[model samples]
Target: MHAGTSNFLKAFPIKFAILIATFISLLLVGCSDEAPGAKVPAFKAPDSKAAAKSGAPGGKGPGGPGGRGNKTFAVEGYIAEFHKPSGSFQTMATLEALNRVELSAAANGRLVNLYAKDGASVQKGSLLAKIDDSELKAQLKQAESSLHLAQQKMERTKGLVEKNAATTTDMEAAEASLKSAEASVELIKAQIAKTEVRAPFSGKLGFVNVSVGAWVTTGTSIATLSEVTKLKAKFALPQRYATTLKVGNPITLIDEERAIQKVGKVTALDATISESSRTRQIMVTVDNSKGELIAGGYAKVSVELQSGRTQTIPVPAEALTLDKDGAYIFVVQDGKASMRRVETGLRTPIAVDVISGLNEGDTVITSGLISIRQGSSVRIREIRNNTDYEVD
Candidate 1:
């Protein structure tokens, strides 16, 4: 081959290789513009109104092509109703006697006399036990002797003064002495009274914590005395119900263990709400004149806010939602889910009392909560009563 021709052939091979590499790069760039099966289309300006209606970046509205407009969440709905009202709320309460006290020894001494029998009824001011007041009686006798002597001396001093045999100052001193002796006698008698244990009120006695001859100090418990003519149920109520609960409102007390139910009346309420628990203390007084109930037992207390029949709208509990803003629920309005802030009262396993923000005969969305949003289109596949809906 000629030298010039050979050089041209070698340069041609290098140029051909460069052309192949450029073609491969062009193919890669084309592939990068779209997925394997996708086709690139011409660009078009998004319609502002349609984009706003869709609430999305694309102009395809809910009903538009390539949009979620036609999509609707299938959910269960419940018709809220004004049902016959029952208890406003139920809470655990502690039962207390109308009057209860632990009788303690007023004076420190050995119990010389004790009438200790459990469940024994006693009368007010009755002597239950008498302590050994022997030393006190001796002191009283000594004081009486001194009192007698002082009385005699005072009479003599008065006579002397009238007869001009004694000074007025002397007579005054004698009278003062007589008063001092009388005080001493009374003091000894009061001390003797302390040695005896007397019933402060008419009630039944508990177990005798001390026996005769058992030495006890002041404030030592002897027995418990409880007046069970009536009972009090004490419980705490949420502060939100403070306005509805009044001093004379009726309440129901239930002893589940004994299956006993009794009606009671609100007697007292806390003046201020508790900051920590946001609740108010309540005391309900119940008639126990027949001795049907025992004190110091627990009871289930239910409060009635109204005098007679009450009506309140109730919704399925699952329909209720809570957030930092407080409780809310979703109601189907115009075939779309609309959220409503609600004030709720009592709640049951299946239903929640809607105090406000909802009305009777309103449709509440009970199911498909996870897939629904505010203003989302919803289709109620099944409509049921508020109490009939079950949470899945």
Candidate 2:
């Protein structure tokens, strides 16, 4: 029995060596069986640790035929537009009346008639008030009588000179006296006309400084007149937008404090940038026939930047992702996510115009962007037709 045990021990080592040789041969044959450059289909393998805990193999067969990946990604997409036409920008603005004036007394006199009331509408050249002209009118009457007497003396002198009754020098002196009297009459008439005050233009009247029977002097401010039929808004922006600002461009007036809104057009632009603000001033004209807007009021001006280009590539603003490198986006191509860097141009509230790196018809992932890397295989479970705005 001792001799049989030694022989068995020796044979056991030889059998073990044979088993090792056979395993190496199988491994070599298995490696050579696959042809070079041939692809092996991939499939989700079970977890090795779980398989070992359950005492099962981790290997699994390839996915079902059709060359489609098994991993599915639920996501929403936005199709970029290549022909977006417009964009919007907003800025602070100041409202001013198209025409405003402070009516002042042109001459010193007692106010006899007050024709204009507070907040009253008056037409151009309309009567507003009249000052007492009693003294001036009396002087005008005396001047007219003196001028008539001077004219009679000049006529009598001319006839006497023709008949040799008077000299030519006396006739010339009479004519000069007649001219002096005529000048006095015109001066008094002009002074009397100044007593009647009139509106300079059509507008609404403000508070009056004097009432009837009150004494007023020249240069005394009487009231304010504003042409509220139309209004003008002035706003400023960076000098870079000088070329983009055009005559007749659209402008929207928004007064959030009073909840008022109106539309207007850019009437004029400053010739150069303002040195103090380093900005370009633009003027917008709006119709205020309804008297809704007040002069010297506050509001916001929204300017639409059309950039003169009718076509632009637009993508959802939220779809854009920013990094230190620059702006980038994830696009789905052939059921896979591809990350691409892009350059942006004009941006609106809803979307951004892509200047480069993306083309029309490129599907951009607007939703379900987390955890997806470049070249990630994805199965589209839901295709959203909304390509204009963000999902949320």
Candidate 3:
């Protein structure tokens, strides 16, 4: 019985150990099934470190992307050669008029006749319009009759006074009567002449403001006449150029496109600068027999400053950019854009002169500049079969 009891105790201890092992294995299998997959989340590692640093009381890192630097900016520019003046700047052509006048009536009267129309050629002393003069002619006739009678009496009194047949006072009265009648006739004739309006100078007439039977007052404009056969353009120049400009100086007037249409000579220059504008007036005359030029047209004037020859670098105006440091451009080097600051001189609508900060044979990025910043990588596309570097 002691042996059997010892055997039962040994079997019991073995069974208890086996049950504890099986329970632990099942618990581990259940826990493993409940846990998540092995794939790690993106950026979680770095984010965890960032959160820890931020939560720290005295962290060194800035809050939420504030430590990032300036954003990259893209821009475009073009390559151009710098130019220095060779002889002188080209002359600019401008339109101007020398003399302008408005024709008006001298006396108040109804317009009886109009002989001239707009754009009509007229000569000096040519009759333009006529006012009613019937009353003036009747007064002239009466004065003439009185003068005839007065002269006859004066002749008789002179002979009588010489022959001692008339008193001295009577002779004097005859003389005064004759003079008064003659003066009255002349005054009436003068009024009659005023009725006929004549041209003061030979020129083409402008529009006539008054029509026949229209009552016009003194100093009312009748028409405008101008001599456009020869035109004069007057412009103001800075006082500094006053000394250089003189009468008879040859000037080439340039149209807006820098085309030289006419050559003119300086006719006059004001002696002093105007106090308000600090500019002196200059007058230039050009032959316009063809009537191609009209009055009051704008022109550009180019004057030769110095007689020295220098290389000039001309670039298109669109290739220029401006920043806080004046003007600049972008130059592409080894697939990277380099910011280059430039100095600009004369500027035209199409082109500008570069004074400094660029060299010949350098390629400049004229397009795609708005997408590039300094030291940015770029992909250059070749302009297929396009020789001209024109900006759209």
* RMSD of each predicted structure: 7.6, 14.9, 12.6
Model 1 regions more than 4 Å off = 1-84, 87-94, 156-168, 236-265, 272-280, 286-290, 298-302, 306-392
Q: Tens-digit lDDT track for model 3 on 280-360?
A: 878888887777677667666655545433344566666678877799877777767777788865555676566687787
Candidate No. with top TM-score:
1
Error of 1 at 115 (Å): 3.4
- The model with the greater TM-score, 2 or 3, is 2
Over 4 Å off in model 2, which ranges? Answer: 1-86, 157-168, 309-392
Worst 10 residues of 2 by lDDT: 59-68
Best by lDDT: 1
lDDT of 3 at 260: 41
- Candidate 1: give the clashing pairs: 62-69
Q: TM-score for each prediction?
A: 0.62, 0.55, 0.53
Query: Candidate 3, TM-score vs. the true structure?
Result: 0.53
* lDDT of every model, 2 decimals: 0.84, 0.81, 0.71
How far does residue 323 in candidate 3 sit from its true spot (Å)? 38
Error of 2 at 114 (Å): 1.2
Scanning candidate 1 in windows of ten residues, the lowest lDDT window is 383-392
Q: Ranking under TM-score, best-scoring first? A: 1, 2, 3
